[model samples]
Target: MNFLGFFNITTVALALMFIGSIGMLVVKKPIDKVILYSIVDAGFLLAVVTFKYLDVAFAIAILGPVSTIIFLMSILKIDRIRHNNREGGPNV
Candidate 1:
């Protein structure tokens, strides 16, 4: 591609990453965090795709869902721990 095309794609990828960072900082919920992470991952993948690195893009895309799932699981675990702490002791 031409220089202009390359510049445009890079600009878009940067914008996506910036927006994802903002979302990650501003949002407090687990679901929102997951979404923001997905956006960031997408931005990275877009950058790779723009540079014609299809193998890297495919690898990143495949890993995205697993990362998201792990994030969700951690969030749930934290919430459960907090809840248990608040409840004082185990039930009879």
Candidate 2:
């Protein structure tokens, strides 16, 4: 099945990973990093699926978003703390 004209799922997954990695390296902002991270994460999940590891793919689908949320929450908390410090507010 020449879906998207690709040889196989592995090729598609690898291409995704390569593009995401390059984007991650090039992006400067933290939010952009997160977006790139999601791309890389999706690539990894696709790779898992390609290997016929449905269980692993299910786990990744469940945990990947959780990890991304953790990263986003941390970024928000850090930014808030920095803003507070800059405004002479309490550092709590």
In candidate 2, what residue range of length 10 has the lowest lDDT sum? 1-10
Q: Write the per-residue lDDT of candidate 1 for residues 4-86, one digit (tens) a residue.
A: 76568788898889999999999988788888888888888898999999998898889888988888998888888878778
Question: What TM-score would you give candidate 1 relative to the actual structure?
Answer: 0.82
lDDT of each residue in 1-92, candidate 2, tens digit only: 65676567898789889999999899888899899999899999999999999999999999999999999999899889999999999977
Q: Which model scores highest in TM-score?
A: 1
Runs off by more than 4 Å, candidate 2: 1-7
TM-score of each: 0.82, 0.81
Models, CA RMSD each: 4.1, 2.4
Q: Report lDDT per candidate.
A: 0.86, 0.92
**Residue 44 lDDT in candidate 2:** 94
